[model samples]
Target chain A: MLSMVKECRRTKVFKPVLDHIPYAKFIGMGCEQFGDEYIFTLPSNDNNLGNPTLPAIHGGVLGGFLENSAIIHLLLKLDTPRLPKTIDFSIDYLRAGRHKDTFAICEITRQGRRAANVSMYAWQTKQSEPTAVARAHFLLEST
Target chain B: MKENNEALADFCQRGMADIKHSEVLGIETVSASNESITLKLPYSLNLVGDMETGALHGGAIFTLADQTSGFAVFSHLHPQIRIAPTLDLRIDHMRKSTKGMDLFCTARCYRYTDNIAFTRAVLYENDIDNPVAHAVGSFMFLETVKDQGWLK
Candidate 1:
């Protein structure tokens, strides 16, 4: 796993996958390598707001970021070049995501031959207090 | 009946205007009532998730469902509440959405308490029978028990 992470870091293999997702581009989502992990960032944008009264980020935008983060994380970890197809996604909105920079990290809880489960957490100001947490299952193509 | 329809139309317009993300997605209200609300999302090139297949992003579909569900809750509550923030949402993608086709979502507030509202919605292209995704969401009412008159 460490070697794969190092190789991906050296090659910057996740760029094309992230670049190809239009929604990610539309929302201005970006990813950065952090040691052995990657941290996904959703920059503050007025178009991403759900409730302007509270000035909170849209729940769906946060969901999208988390889902995309998981997919990118999978791409970095797994050897398959094909994009994973999401089967189902569940999210818990713990707090209102302020209209600001939000970050997310994904952890692969389990990986099987054909399916993988990833859990994601997103935070705005503090990493310890996540604004939202989500889990998703994806169908991976067999190599 | 005509008066109610006009009122619903006005409500839908005002609701969509307040949400920036809905506007970004080009969402429009098809029909709305206190019982249920239906919304439409026009297909856009920017919403494509996979360029090879030209499929609509799951995030876009999820956004449609989430906004529709919130509208369902709002329509159900009508004058009682101004906004209900999402507490949690779950979406199950049945299949990839067809390219160059608009999406529709119909949502209903199945249950509500003093503090929380529960809603379910389905997203489809043309036929509701063939849905692309199904979603269930819980929203916080953000109103006090006294204001909601739950004790009474």
Candidate 2:
């Protein structure tokens, strides 16, 4: 009972935080948050396609989506005034992101006072097989 | 085999056509060569990361650099290759770019074997020495072929 209430309160708090990111809105990414869990969706759009041959999503778009997911999760989890600045980003593309709606889930691997690290897994069809995985570190401001 | 002039023109048109991501970013071809490709990214309000400070989003620069690297690989080995999936990519941001200034990127294909190609790119606004970001990445070529025509 208490857990359900806690979930409702978290959604109310974090939903607005996600909307403030302009790139997320520009890219047409939508989010659903419950507690610390987040599901990020990237809608299939003409602008996101990189290869006109296979109609694959741009590698940058893939990288951006995962990166944004990490930032949002960290923001919501910490409940800070703004999102942390990115330190560095590394991405490994496991497969081609075909023209379709893509989804990503972020897991916080570690957290400290001044910095936080997060890992992201993105998949289009099969959750078991991720299209790309990324690790990003961010510098947090005073919380 | 296409002459140098014809190949350069072809690369510019086909590169803009083949990659929708570049078109969306308003990438303009500055120069092209068999070895490297250079392009420009104009500043856009849509790319701003912070409304308060008016800073351009890092992702926009990242997309530009990634596309430049892919195009560099394509310009060098055009007839023999079609697709190169990125195996890994890394970008290090040095400093925030000046708002409303165009970002210039140059990508060079350092080496490639049968299955993999390595690329490095630099993003700058006014000068190459003072860069906004640096990226080193690798891609997997779908098909590998040794073109004797390319050698000559």
Candidate 3:
């Protein structure tokens, strides 16, 4: 697992895929491997703010981040190199995402031949207390 | 009805301008009424998600739908309410959007109470009958906190 993570980074496999995604770059989302785990980061930017008065991150941005995180997680974990297509995404806003660096962690709940389900949690300060949680279903191409 | 629509359009435009992300995505008010409101998101290279297909990112589509839903709530409440924060949102991607084509979203606030508002939105490129995405969202009205100047 560690070797695979290193290979993905050293070979410039995932970086290019992420770089090519203009929306991911526009929001300044980055992924890093830590001890065989991948963590997605979204740096706070004024252009990503949804509610200026409350200075909160947009709900859609959060949704996007979570969805992308799930896709990237699948890329890293699954053997298939193809990008997963999102089918449906459901998100619950537990608390306001403040203007701060946010982090997301994804767990694959179930992986089938044709589809996979991923659950994601995003938080600012504490992982235990997530600002938002989401579940996404993606259609995977058979290799 | 025309005068009312014009007034709602002005209000929607102002609301869109106040959002930094909406400005970044170039979301504009297409039409506005108390019954429903439509918004447009112009296509840009910066909004692409799929490098192979050159399709617009699902996140960008979600943002447009989310904003349109919020605006629908605003149009429904009008002068009675000033702010409604999103409580939760769910989006279903029906199909991949065509590249270089602008996306449009129309949303309606179907139900509301003093504290919460419910809305649904459809996103499309050309035909409303064939939407690329659909969204349902609930928003929280801060009327109870109005005494603390929270609504101001």
Candidate 4:
């Protein structure tokens, strides 16, 4: 367990918008705490292709990023060591991701003993538009 | 032996090109006509140590649904046509998957218009009788190329 936590800290997974998801290293979904905002960036890779072309950031990747953002926010605020279970996630892909790059800035709306709620917007460079938006619910484990 | 079958094989190949980056969650061969595609949960892809419990991670499941849905749409498109990111997706976990279990997913596109295509995915684990989760999603065609202003 301690090693997992250590792994979490060593990797981008412990960072906001990047944790708890697969392929973080390849996709470039890194986390940075920028003063009041928690920013997550999704870097483009070889697989992201289509008409408009994208890092091909899959919706599942976006969902994972948002979900991680929510739980990490809760973890940062609390004095507990509990893992979070995703209750539900709803994501709206507003625009297709362009090859340049993209990411999201998230904020926690509510944090309770058992559950937490978070919302975020994903913006890409080429489109300069909000490509996706998400709201997720998480259940915290007991410490 | 048929054009449709050839296409299905190609689609799966392209989808699974990057095994390390994206594991095959599940692949269900629907009818030969490319009517519907169902994929199972990708048992192998998950957090370390977490994989041992055989519990299907929600993120993996969601990614599977998205990829399956994307493939479902791609199967019907022209050879050159391809889809980008999912425009929208909503997933609900009905229950946890069985331990060390493989999941099943059935994805179908009910409607296909010029701009967007819609799909539904049903995911099951040990028992097909009860599904572990359900997902409904849509993807938009990136048919046009624009000067992505960000590059400048």
Misplaced by over 4 Å in model 4 are A1-28, A43-55, A126-128, B1-10, B18-33, B45-54, B75-85, B142-152
Sort by lDDT, top down from the best = 3, 1, 2, 4
Write the residue-wise lDDT of candidate 1 on B1-152 in tens digits: 41235566567777677789988889999888888888999999899888777888888888898889987887766665545789999999999999899999999899988788899999999999999999999998766332422111
Q: Write the per-residue lDDT of candidate 2 for residues A1-143, one digit (tens) a residue.
A: 22333453455544455456677777778777555467888989998898776768999988888888887777656655555777778899998899999999998788888888889999999999899999888887773
TM-score of chain A of 2: 0.87
* Per-prediction TM-score to the true structure, in the order listed: 0.91, 0.87, 0.92, 0.72
A127 Cα displacement, candidate 4 (Å)? 11
* Interface RMSD to the true structure, each candidate: 3.8, 4.1, 2.4, 5.6
lDDT of 1 at A17: 59
Q: Report the lDDT tens digits of candidate 3 across residue range B48-143.
A: 888778889888998898889988998866755557778888999999999899999999999988788999999999999999999999998765
Over 4 Å off in model 1, which ranges? Answer: A1-8, A13-15, B1-4, B144-152
| Model-by-model DockQ, in order | 0.57, 0.48, 0.64, 0.30
Model 4 per-residue lDDT tens digits across residues A36-94? 45566666654433322234455666666565555555555444455566778889977
Find the number of clashing residue pairs for candidate 2.
0
Assess the local accuracy of residue A89 in candidate 1 as a C-alpha lDDT between 0 and 100: 96
Whole-model lDDT per candidate:
0.85, 0.78, 0.86, 0.61
Chain A (candidate 3) TM-score to true chain A: 0.90
Tens-digit lDDT track for model 2 on B46-104? 87766666666777878888888877777677554556778888888888778888999
What RMSD does each model have against the real structure? 4.4, 5.3, 3.1, 6.0
lDDT of 1 at B8: 66
**Candidate 4 per-residue lDDT over residues B1-152, each given as its tens digit:** 32345666555655454432344333343332366666554455443113334465566677777767777786565354454447888888777666666767767777888888998888887565698888899877776655433221
Error of 4 at B138 (Å): 2.0
- Minimum summed lDDT over a 10-residue window in model 4 chain A is located at A46-55
Clashing pairs in 4: A13-A19, A48-A55, A48-A56, A93-B87, B25-B42, B26-B40, B41-B103, B54-B100
Q: Would you list the rank order by DockQ, best first?
A: 3, 1, 2, 4
Candidate 1 per-residue lDDT, tens place, A1-143, comes to 33545465687665555667898888889888867888999999999998776678989898988988998788788875577889999999999999999999999999999999999999989999999999999999864
